[model samples]
Target: MCNNQLTITNPRYLKYARITGNPVHVYSGRDDYRLRVPCGHCDDCLKRRQQQWFSRAHHLMKRMALRPDQCLFCTFTLKPSVYEQAKEKPYIPIRQFLDRLRKHPRFREKDPITKRYRYRKVKFPYLFVVEFADGKTAAKRGRVSTHRMHYHAILFGCPLYWWQVRDLWQGDVVDEAKGWYTGMGKAEVDPLESESGVRYVLKYMTKDCAAHQYISDVDARKNGKLIVSHGFGRLSKEDIKIMRKNMLRGASSWFCHFINNYRYSIPRYWKTACFSPNEIRCRNDSLIPGILRDFVKKRYPFPDFTFQQQQQIYNCLLWP
Candidate 1:
C-alpha cells in the first residue's frame, strides 16, 4: 500500500512552483471554514483579523446571554483645544483621553438640591474599538475641518445616559477630565438591541489599515488602538501568547498529517496539489513481506493513487 506522503500536497511544493496559494482553510464546522492567512498586516489581513475578533465577540456575547439593551454602544470623539490644535501630532491628547477613560473614569458632581458631593466612576468590563481620521473626508461646506480620532465602545453593566457618559470624559477638570465641554467632540450613546449595531461598530475597524492610517502612526506605544477591552471575549496579552504558541507556522510534516486527517473535509477552494521536483532523489523503498504487501495492495489499491493522479492532473491543467 502507498504511504502517507501520497495524500495532500505540501505547501512548500506549491510555493516552490510559484503558484498563488489559497488562504489557510480552518474548518470550523461541517461545511464552514475560516480563511486566515497572513499578508504583512495589509488591508486583507487586517480585515480577516477584525472578522475573527468580531466572531469572538459575537460568540462571547451570545454565551453570556447578554441582551442588546443590556449593553451600551457609544462613540467618544476628541476635540481640538487651543493648545492641541497647534500641535503637529494632535492624536497625543486623544490617546491620553482614551487612557483616562479606560483606567480612571472617576468624576465628581454636586447635587443642586441637596448641596451634597457625589463621585462616580465608569469602570472595566467594557469593549472599545478605535478608528482615526483626519476629518478632511467628513468635512462639509461651512463646517470646520480638524483631526478626528475616536473610539466605538460597548459598555457592559453600565446604564449611563449620553450626557452623563459625555461628562465622564469632559466633566470638571480641577478633578480630572479627558475631553472638552464645547460639544465639538460628542459622545453618542445608544442601546444595542440588535445584531446590526454590533456589525456597525465593527465595520470600520480594518479600514484604517486599508488607508494606511494605523494608530501606531500616531503613537507607536499606544494601547487600545486596534481592538482592546475587558471582560467577555477579551484576549489579553497572555491569551495572545498562548494562541501564538499554538499557531502553526509554515508547512511541515505535521501540516501534511493535518491535511490528510481532514482530506475529506477540506473546502474545494483550498488549493491542494504538488509540483515536480527540480532534482529528483532516488531512495530505496521500505521492505515488506510479499504476502503482506499483496494483501495491503488488494485492500487499499485506490487510496493513494487517486491523490497522486489528482496532483499530476492539476499540474497538467496549469501548463499552457
Candidate 2:
C-alpha cells in the first residue's frame, strides 16, 4: 500500500470554519489529520482512474449508439529495431505512428465526385492504452525474451478489413507471394463481440509492468499524446459533468471530496466535519440545536435517522 497520505493543515479551511461559526475542533492525535491524496503512481489511484475511464468509455459507447458489432479491438506494434532506437522515449514513435496511421490515404480518401479529400462520414471514437511488456513469460512458450511495446485499442464504427489496417500500418509494403503486406511491424484487428470487450481494452489503463525491465508505463500516460481519433472528438464538458454527478450520487463525503479535488490536499473542514474516529455518546434528538438539525436535514434528506443514529447526525453537523 502507498503510505503517501498527505496532511491537511491549510489555514483557509480554518478561516472558513470560523466565518461560518463552526469553529473546527482540533484533534490531538496526528493520525486524525491524514488525507488520502490521489497520487497517480499508486495502485489505489490507478484503480480509481481505471474505473473513471471505464465509466467514460461505457458512457461514450452508449452516447454514440454503437453496438458490439460496430466496434473492433485492434493492436499495433513497432519493429524490434525501432523499439530499441526509441526505448527511452517510446511515446515519440507511438505518437508518430498513430498520427501517420490516422492521415493514411485509406483512412482519409478523396471524394470522387468533388475531388476533395474528406474523412469518412461514420464516427470513429477510439480509446487506446500504450503497453510495454517485457516478454519474460515467453520463455515458457519457447520464445525469446525481449522487450515488447504495443498499443491495445477499442475502435468504434470501423469499416475496414484487417488486411486493410495491416497495409495502412505497414505503409503498403506488399509481399506478393504471401498476399499480404509484410512491412515494418504487426497489426491485428478483431471484431468486438460483446460489452466485455470494452472492459478488456480499458483494463490496460491500470495494467502494471515490471519496473526493473523498463520505465514505468505510467510515464507514457503522462505524455498525453497517445490518443488517436477521426470523426468523434473528446468527451464534452457537459458529458463529463453528467458522468461525475451520476458517480457521486449516494457516495460518501470523503470519496466525493477526494474525487472532486484530486491531487490537492484535503480541506481541514472535510477531516473535522465529515469523518471522525470517536463514537458518539449523545443520542437525544431534543439535545440537537434547531438550526444545526435543519441544516443537516436539508443537506442530507435521504437517510431515515433512527434514535441510535441521531447522535451521528449531530456529530456530522457540529463536530465535537
Candidate 3:
C-alpha cells in the first residue's frame, strides 16, 4: 500500500480513506491493530495487504470464480463468521438522530407522506461509506472489509433525502428501512455489475468505522467558505450551532445568526470588515474577509439588543 498519498486509481466516490503503512486504529473485529484499506484499492495493492475481506450485503465482493478450497488470502482458508465467533459492535440507537433528521426541512423518507407527491431527489446524497486501512504494514499489510448501504427516496413532500445503513445484520428489526430494488445497474459499462450494482456490492463490506472522531474538530470558516463558494447564501441552524460549539473556530453567537441566516444577495453584511482572522488562519478565499466587508458596509449590520438581551445572548466571559 502507498503511504505517500498516492492512488492507483481515483476512488469511485469522493471519500474513501487512504491505505497506510502505519497501524492507526483499534477494532474488536481484528485480533490486532490494523491499517484500514479502502475497497477501491487495486488488486495488486489489496493482495499486498494479506486480509480476508468479506461482506454479507453484496455477494460480489467474494464472487470471484475460484474454487471453494482456494485460499481467501495467501492460502488462508475462509472462515465465515458464525454467530459464535463474530463480535458485533454495540448498535447505535437511531431513534434520536433519526428524529432530529426528520425534523429538518430536508428530511424525506420513502413513506406515504412522500410517495404520492414528492417530485425529485437530492442533487447529492449525504450517506457515505468511508473506508480506512486495517492491520500492520511491515508486519501484516491489510485491507478494510468494505460496505455501507446508502438509501435514497423522493416519496414524500420532503422530497430528496438519504441515509446510511451501518449494519445490515440488524435488518431483522429494520426491514422497512432496508428496502431496496436491487439488480439495477449503477453504470452502463458493467455487465454483471453496473455502477449501481458495483456500488450495491460495495455497500455490504463495511470495515469498523472509527473515523467520525477525526471530523470532530473540523474548521468552520473554511468549511463554510467552501459552501458559500458553491453559491449557497445561507446556512442551517445546525451549521451555526456546530460553529458556536467550537467545532468551528472563531464562531461567535452573533456572527452565527448573521452568517447562518442572512442571505448573500444582500451585500451589506460583510463587505468591508477586517478580512483577516485573529485566531485560526482562515483558509484561502475564505469569504470571511468578504463577509466582514459586508458587515462593515452595513455599519456592523448587527443587533444592538437591550442590555438584558445582550446578557442573555452571550456568556459572561464573552459579554462585550
Candidate 4:
C-alpha cells in the first residue's frame, strides 16, 4: 500500500507549511520518517503523479507561450530487429536517436558570426512518453515475443512538414534483403489543432499499461522517470514560487483540501468535517459566487434587475 501521509521535519518546509496550507516533503527520500519510495503501481500515488504531470504540462505550455499551430504530435517506432538488439535497454538507443534527430542539419542554420551550424530560432520544447505493444504474430510463431517499444511525443516549434519529418526519420538505411532503402519501422506526425490535442498527448503518461511497461524496464524503473523532456530548461526557485501561486489561484476546492491535509497529522477542522453527517462544503463558499454571477451575467444578461433587486438576488444566492 502507498503511504498517503508524510511527516514534516525540515525547518524550511515547516515554515512553508505554516505560511501556505501546503505540506512539503521530500519525494523518494530514504529517511525513516519519510514515506517509502513510490511503487508506481499504487492507485493513489499514480493519480497524484498524473495530476502533477498535468500541472507541469499546463505550466510549460503557458510559460513557453506555445500555440496550437506551433505544436506537433509525433509517434516514433523502432524496427523489430533494432528492438531485438537492445531489448534489455530499448530506451537507450531511442534517446540517442532523438538526440541525433534534434541536431539534424535540416533544423539548423549557419551563425553569421562564427559560421557554425546552430539550431533554428525555435526552442523545440518536447515531451515523450514511451509505450509498448505486444506482437501477436511473433507470439503465434512460438518465438519469444517481447514487447515492442515506441514513443508518443508532443513537440513545439517544429517547422518540418509531416512528410518531411517522416523522410528525415526514415534516415538513409538501405535494406539489402529488400533491395531498397528503409528506415525505422514507422513515424507519424500531425499538427496540434487545439489545446485538447496537447492534453491528448499528455494522457499517455496516465495510462496504467504504459506506466507498467515503463516500470518493467530496469533502467527507467531505477530512474523513476515516467516521461522524457528536452529544451524546456530547468525551473529556478523564483519560477517554482510563481508556479505554486498560479496553482493555488486556479486549483479547485477539493485540491485545496488535499494539499492542506497532505501531512500525517490531519487538521482538526477536516477531522470534524469527516465525522459530520452533513455533506461538507468549502470553507469560503462566497469566493466563487461573485465570479460565477459575473460570468453568467456577462454571457446571459437575463431580465435586467434594479439595484434593490440585485441586492436581493445576491442575498438569496449567498444564503447559508
Q: What are the root-mean-square deviations of the candidates from the true structure over C-alphas?
A: 15.6, 11.4, 23.3, 13.3
Which of 2 and 4 is ahead in TM-score?
2
What would the TM-scores of all predictions be? Answer: 0.46, 0.55, 0.17, 0.53
- Looking at candidate 3, what is the lDDT of residue 51? 19
Candidate numbers sorted by TM-score from highest down: 2, 4, 1, 3
Local accuracy of candidate 1 as per-residue lDDT tens digits, 1-320: 11111233345544544654543332223221322234434565555555555555554565567777777788866555633451344444445554555443345667788999765555535656655554656675556654445667776555455456666655554322544464336567777777567767766565555364444554322222554444446444564444334322322221121321331211111111111122111111121233344544564466665756644544443321
Candidate 3 residues lying further than 4 Å off, grouped into runs, are: 1-125, 130-276, 281-320
Local distance difference test, each candidate: 0.48, 0.57, 0.26, 0.56
Q: Write the per-residue lDDT of candidate 3 for residues 1-320, one digit (tens) a residue.
A: 33332322223211222343323332224322233344533443333221121111112222322222221110001112321121121112122223333444444445576465332333211111222212233234345432211222111111222222211112223234544222111111112222233233233232222222222232111110100012112324553344345323432322322322431111212211212344324432354455444444354334655545544444321221
Model 4 Cα displacement at 56 (Å)?
A: 1.2
Write the number of the candidate with greater TM-score, choosing between 1 and 3.
1
Q: How many collisions per candidate?
A: 1, 0, 36, 0
Error of 2 at 51 (Å): 1.3
Question: Can you give the lDDT of residue 147 in candidate 1?
Answer: 43
Worst 10 residues of 1 by lDDT: 279-288
